[model samples]
Target: MFKNEELEINLGPQHPSTHGVLRVKLRLDGETIVKCTPIVGYLHRGVEKICENKTFFQGQVWTDRMDYVAAVSNNLGWAESVEKLFGIHVPRRAHYVRTMMTELNRISSHLLWLGTHALDIGAMTVFLYAFREREQILDCFESFCGARLTTTAFRIGGLREDIPPGFIKQVQAFQDRFLDCIDEYETLLTENRIWKRRTIGIAPINADECIAFGVTGPVLRAAGVKYDVRKAFPYAAYAEMNFEIPTRTEADTYARYLVRLEEFRQSHHIIQQCIDGLPEGNVMAKIPKVLKSEVNEIYHPIEAPKGELGYYLVGEKGGQNPYRFHVRGPSFVNLQALPQMTEGRLLADVIAAIGTLDVVLGEVDR
Candidate 1:
């Protein structure tokens, strides 16, 4: 008699497919995973611990680095939290601009995912194509705040800078050309046989399991629950803007792909609305030279690329320094389901599953 023996295998802390310093210890029977454990913390930069030492205003910059893929949205979350703690309201124009940049960041994130995800699935052209588009968005970030990644352009009271005079035209140009680019991406992989074979029905889970696991973003939406923070609980003028929540019921790798594809379109619409209806006002609310003195703060919010971001701040009375600060990141919570989600799947499917989760290690390990 012949029997299959169990084997324990290591996926990576250095593997490119694991998406940034994630190491998986897998117990397997033949090629099938029996039990899986994800080991992280390789990238823990002590962001929270570092925040405690910095002033509230200074701490907000650290949030930008927590998720390099969508730093503007990360910045928005921290700024909103600090504003909430201080009880200060941003101007209408600042609200509109924040919405604009955040939506752009969302599209950029999805593009990065699409490219890298496609590359993992064996579509070579997509990696270059996706990064090509990403470079343009990063250029916009540089033009606005001088940093392509980890942009700390949002302030506690409002935006760090206003849109330059010709910036609107540049943004509009990107929008105009975006449809063709999207169509090209879809053409390459959306209905491709290999892509579908690698993704469909792989490591399936339902909405119940996803909710129980506390999964959010495309993972939850792919399970058929349309619980987007933007739609369910609107912030950053999202309530005023027009957009739709993209959902699917497959709860498989393919469903997650479709959900993200639909999301890209919805985000595009939101950006156009923000640009069209942008209000006029001071880019930033005037603050005292001493950040530790003068005003406290107010409410602020912007829809991040991942999901709803909740921020709360406690600041010193009559000082600009924040006494307390907290940020709720969607990626960290979303990643909690990895072991549960990856168990019972093949090793090849493990990579497929993680790609569908779309986790950035910086956010996951933050």
Candidate 2:
């Protein structure tokens, strides 16, 4: 007599590759995955609830803790949303500086994703090369803001101060040599036989499914959706920046890799445009010393590293703290597609799927 049985296993709430306290309950028929269910909240910190209780000025700090790797981007969203709430007009120079720093933050976030995602798939050389560039970006962040990782770099209406003296020259020096660095990443992993074998045609999700799942960013772009918040909904200085949204129809792990590499080029282009076209004016905007709001609600979205990071706020009359607050974190939304990407695929491909999504659990569980 012969018999068949499906094995059910938990991938992790603490494994290195799950990328942050994420556990997937997987049912496997031999080595093929029958189903995958991602379990989150092991790292939940009630960030939204905390923000509702704090003054608007103090709430931005908590945004830094969510998606800590892309904290500058988080800062941008929080500050901009608050500005929107109070009808604040940010200075043109401040917008340019914000744009430049946010683009730099995007590059830094992608470099980390490249390094760790590659490392997860056994491409060690690419990991080292990617981190080298990431370190330089972090150094730039440290110079601009006192802290490197959790940088509360922006205020409500504008930046806290003007860009530090010599900042332009420092960024220029990095910009001059950075294209070559991107080429180096390509040489190591773009055509490598092992890298291709691990990534190509693996962990694919179609464009229709991506949209249905509310997935955005490179993952959705790889499916040929061509939707980007920066392009679709202009924010900060993106209205003036000239760049293209990179897209591919393959919708596999390999396609996402290519899309992000192209994004690296575009982000570099935006930074250059900022450095060359930076206007001279006040970096801070004029607003009331104490921010108070009438009954109003707003939802502001920006293109963060992973995807569309949106902040939703409800203001009360003369309220110093938000009446209600919520965050539509990309990681939380994108994680919904995991089961669709992994079910009926080989067990090992689940790792590729999680990595391709490029989620940060801090934002996921926040």
Candidate 3:
């Protein structure tokens, strides 16, 4: 009688390809992943618990840290959630600015994903090329806010201030030139034999499975779902902006790559519209000197760069701080599908699967 034995191996918590302290325990049958278990929490900072201790205004800072790469989007989501709870109406001009910033942050976040994902798949040139464009976006961000990475640029009612004199021109210049940058990246990877072979058919999950797993953002869209929070539930001038939600039926790693690439174009379009039709008015709205909410509890979700980033706020009437605060981070939810995607695939394909998900550990563990 012959017997087969499965081999168990740990893939991270320190491995570079696992991307930031993510440990995956893999049961391998000779390089074929028979079973996979993702272990997170290495980056946990108790962001939700910390928010309960801080005033609503101060809690905005921690949101930036959750998805540190896409800080502007985090700021917008946090501010809008508080605004909804307080019934504070942001000025029209402020909404436009917020939309523009959020879109720019989206592009920046995607650029980082592209670079790092390509690097993981052995396309070194694409990494440098992607970062070249990302740097310009970060420069624009630093010009608007003092910080490039963790820019807590939004306030509970509106923005911290108006756009600087040359900020619009700077953004416009980048917007005009950015499409060519995307083309350059595609030239390097979209049709490359190795790139296609590595990504095209790896880790496919159907739209039904994605929904069942509570997935959102590009992963869900790549699986042929047309759900986008911005279009379905608009906020922060997204209703006024015209853009298409890119979707693919392939439901594979390559499809996700294509969807995100098209998203770059759509984000550019939204920003251009904001610039062309930007209304002139107060950037800040009138609110009480001290922040307090009559609403006992409320939940608000925004189309963050990663996915639907929702916040649940609980507090009593006239409370200075939230009694309880919880954040539904997209990365945290999205990470759940990792094991499903990686199981039964070749061990080498694990890196490709993880890269395609575009997860940030900070958001996952927070």
Best by lDDT: 2
**Deviation in Å, model 3, residue 55 alpha carbon:** 0.5
lDDT of 3 by residue, 142-245 (tens): 98988999999989888878998899999999998998988998899999999999999998888888998899999999999999999998999999999999
Per-residue accuracy of model 2 over 1-366 as CA lDDT, tens digit each:
866999999999978998889999999999999989999999999999999999999999999999989999999999999999989999999999999999999999999999999989988888888888888888888889889999999998899989998889988888998899999999999989999999999999999999999999999999999899999999999999999999999999999999999999999999999999999999998878888889999999999999999999999999999999999999999999999998999999988889999999999999
Off by over 4 Å in 2: none
Candidate lDDT scores, in order, read 0.80, 0.94, 0.91
- Candidate 2 lDDT (Cα, 0 to 1): 0.94
How far off is model 3, as Cα RMSD?
Answer: 1.3
Per-candidate TM-scores read 0.93, 0.99, 0.98
Backbone clashes per model, in order? 10, 0, 0
Sequence-dependent TM-score of model 2? 0.99
By TM-score, highest first, what's the ranking? 2, 3, 1
